[model samples]
Structures are given as structure tokens and as C-alpha cells.
Target: MFKFTLKRFGYMLLTLFIASSITFMLIHAMPGDPLAVAARKLPEQIKANYYAKYGLNKPLLTQYGLFVKNAVKGDLGQSLASPGRDITETIMKHAPISARIGGQGLILGVTIGILLGIVAAFKRGKWPDYLVMFIAIVGISVPSFVVASLLQFFFTVKLTWLPTTGWGEFKHTILPTIALSLSPIATYARYMRANCLDVIGQDYIITAKAKGVSNVSLVFKHVIRNAILPAITLLGPQVAGIFTGSFVVESIFSIPGLGQYFVSAITDRDYTMIMGQSIFVSALFIVALFLVDIIYGLVDPRIRVSSGKR
Candidate 1:
């Protein structure tokens, strides 16, 4: 297990390096210059000074090398969009907001999805199954942005139950959390239902039943354990998704989160901010995947055995 973890960690580092390199190169390759965008109306001399100050005057290769070096030291440099702000600091400040909303959304979605899926699987062809499936389909079919809008309109605009936008009190979190949760809830429900069905039909489940195991014991001890394994795999990516924040959801709701910064960084041609966010998000995803792999070993001994052999 230790060796397997080390191997996965190495792979994660390699993945981050490649992903960061690609992002750096692509942003530099884009047509518009950050300096040009920042100093559209400023004189050429001032622009030159700004370029020198930010190392924008340096060759692309030199900049890339410097960025990688500093990144290794945990310095992501300054944000071009927000002058005087460190990119790392900016991300740190905003990420918590995204994490809060996204975490709630994930928890809510996962809990509801698993329960509904269990009901559907247990009931099989009953009306309850049909209703759960229908809701899941609707959740999957609808986009998050649309869900955000509808939620805002109904809960905030019409009912005045929640604030329309901005993050502050607990009331502000409700709409956005629900909006963000919809797709995930739907996805989890479908996946859970399928996994539960497959687990139920397995020979072990039949054996348990034949042995006169209680229904609750059969489910809680065996069915849920096996059925939920796949969902554990999904959690890594889901955590990454939540931490990175949703651009559309943040934008529509006017939440001051990483997603808002990410969008603005692109539009304003904030090179450092863009690169910083990209690398940060990529690292999150890689780390999440790595953790998921470790979890697989813990959840199923077969995985640990295979990993050790490899």
C-alpha cells in the first residue's frame, strides 16, 4: 500500500507538471497580451514599465521557467486583473466561499440521491421507483445554470424566501446550493440505482436471503456496502468539482468565489490569474483522483492486492 501510494503520488506530480505546462503555453499562445489589455489607453512607456515590472517583457520560455520555479516554492505570482494581489492569496480567499456552497450541495445531493436510489431499487417496478427515476431524469436533463435561474426566480424574486445573490448569511447559500446539487443528485441517483440493482442480483445476496438474513441486515451490511463503493470513486472528482466552483452558478448568483475570478481572468486577459487558477484546479483534480485510488484499496482488498502486485 505504501509503495502504491508513492507510485500514485509520483504520477500526480507528473500530471500536474504536464497540465501546468500546457496551460502556460496555451495562455501565452493566445492572441491578446495581458499588458495590452491592462494598458489599453496608457502611453507606450508606461506599458513598457508595467511589462518590465511583471516580467511580461521577458521571453516566453524565461517566463515559463520562472513560473515553474516559483510555483514549486508555492508562489503563484500576482494577479494581473487585481493589481497588488498575489494569485495564491486571491485564490485562497475566494476558494472557501466556493467550498462552503459546493460542499453543502454535494452532501445534500449525495444523501438524497442514495436514499431515492435505495427506494427505487428496493421497490423495483413500483410507483415509488417510477417517481424517483423521473426526478432523476429531470435533474440530469436540466442544466445547472437554468436550475440556478429558476431557483433564484422562485425562491428569491417571487417568494422572497432567499436572497437573489451575494454571499453572506446562511440564507444566501440555500438557492445556489440547491442549484449546484441538482445535476449531481440526479447523477448519483442513477448510478446508485444501477449499482444497487446489480448488487441485489449477485449470488451472494441470494445466498444471504436463503440463509434467512433479515432484510435490514441484508441491505445495511451487504447491499449498501457493495453498492456504495462506486459512489466513493465518484467523490474525488465531485470534490474537485465542488472546490473549483461553478462558473455559471457563481456568475448568475453574483457570488464572490474562484469561479467569478476565473471568468474575469479570461475576459480581462489576466495571464497569471488564468494560469494560477488552471494549475490550482488541475492539481485539485489530480490529488482528488489520487485520494480516490487510495480509497479504492481501503474499500476493497482486491484492489490492494492488485496494486501491490503491479
Candidate 2:
């Protein structure tokens, strides 16, 4: 287990390095003078001074070196978009909001998806199964931004049940969370339903049922416990996707989260802020995957054998 963990960590570092490198190269490759793109608020003399101060006049290698050096020291440099706040500070401020929103969405998504799947599987060919599948198909078809906008229009504007934008209160979180959760819930439901069907049909399940085990206990113990493992196995990637992909939902809802900042940084050509966010996101995604791999080993015995060989 320890050896496997070490190997996974190594892979994580490699993944982060690749992601960071891509972020660096892509930002540098964009057409335009970064400082000019950042906007020339100062006079020519002041601009020259700014260039001299920040070494903006230097070659791309020198700038990349400086950026990497500061990054290694946990200094994300200044945010051109936000003059007073540093890039790291801005990201830190925004991360928790995204995290909270994503966390709630993940829980809601997983729970609803799993329940709907279970019901569908239990009923097999009944109307309940068909209805749930139809809903899942609709969810999978709709884009998140469209869903978010429609939700805001109907739930917020027409009904006034929830806020259209901002993260001011509990109600404000509802629309965004639902929007973020919709696709994942639909996907997970399909996966869970399939797994549940297989487990129920297994010989072990028949034995348990023949022995007169209680229905609730049998579902929980023999059926779901075994069946849901596959669904649980996919959870790590799904969670990572949730937090990272919430950018669209956050933007649509006007939520002040890291996703919003990340998008803004790219659009504004705020290299430092963009790089910092990229690094943070890469690191977070790797860590989530690492933790998930470890959990997979703990829960699924087959993974242990494969991991050992690797």
C-alpha cells in the first residue's frame, strides 16, 4: 500500500508539472503585449518604470524563471485585475466559495442520482424505471449554462423562490447547486442502476434472499453495498470535475468563486493570476485523484492486486 501510494504521488507530480507547463506556455503564447493587455493606466515614463520594476522588458525565459521562482516560494505575485490583492490571496478568498458550492452540489447529485438509480433498478420494466431514465436522458442532454439560466428565469424571476445571483443566503445557493449537479446526477444514476441490476441478479443475492433476509437489510447489505462500489470508484473524478467545471455555473449565477476569477484572469490576460489558479487547480485535482486511488484500494480488494504489480 505504501509503495503504491508513493507511485501514485509520483504520477501526481508529473501530472501537475505537465498542467503547469501547459498553462505557462499557453499564456505566454497568446498574442499581445501582456502589460498592454493588462492595460496601460500609467504614463509612458511610469510604464517604463513599471517595466523596469517587474522585469517586463526581459525575455520570456527570464519572466518564466521569475514566475516559477516566486511560485516555488508560494508567492503568486500580484493580480493585475485586482490591484491591491495578490493573486494567491484572491484565489484563496475565492476557493472556499467554490468549494462550498461544489461540495453541496456533489452531495445532492450523488444522493439523488443513486436513489433514482436504485428505484429504477428495483422496478426494472415498470413506469418508474422508464420515467427516471427519461429524466436522466434530459439532464444529460441539457448544457449547464442553459440549465442555470432557465432555473434563474423560472425559479428566481418568475416564482421568486430563489435568488437570481450572488451568494448572499441559503436560497442563493439553490439554483447554482442544482445546475452544477444535474449532469452528474444523471450520469451516476445510469451507472448505479446498471451496477444494482447486476448485483441483484448475482447468485449470492439469491442465496441471501432464499435465507429470508429482510428486504431492507438485503438491499443495503447484499445489493447496494456490493453494487455501489463501481459508482463509488468513479466518485473521485466526478468530484474533481464538479469543482473545476463549476466555472460556467458560477458565471451564470454571478457567484464570486475561484471559477469566476479563473475565467476573468484568462479573459483579462492576467498571467500571474491565471498561472496561480492553474497551479492550484492542477494540485487540487491531483490530490483528489490520489486520495481517491487510496480509497479505491481500501474499498476494493481487486485494486490491491493491480496496484501491487504497478
User: Which has the greatest TM-score?
Assistant: 1
lDDT of 2: 0.83
How well does each candidate superpose onto the true structure, as a TM-score?
0.95, 0.89
C-alpha local distance difference test of each model: 0.88, 0.83
Give a tens-digit lDDT track for model 2, residues 1-310. 7887788889888888788878888987888876784437788888887776666788978887888788888887887666667888877788888888788888898899999999999999999999889979988999988998999899978999887887778888888888888887898889889999999999989999899999999988788878888887677677677668789898888888888777777788777788888888778877888888887777777886787875
* Candidate 1, superposed: residue stretches over 4 Å from native: 40-46, 243-245
Name every residue pair that clashes in candidate 1: none
Q: Over the stretch 1-310, how does candidate 1's per-residue lDDT look in tens digits?
A: 8888888899999998999999899999998677765688888898889888889889989999999999999999998877899999988899888888898999999999999899899999999999999989999899888999999888888999888988789988888899989877888888889999999999999999999999999999999999999988888889888966476898898888898788888888888999998898889888989999999888887887887786
Worst 10 residues of 2 by lDDT: 32-41
* TM-score, structure 1 vs. true: 0.95
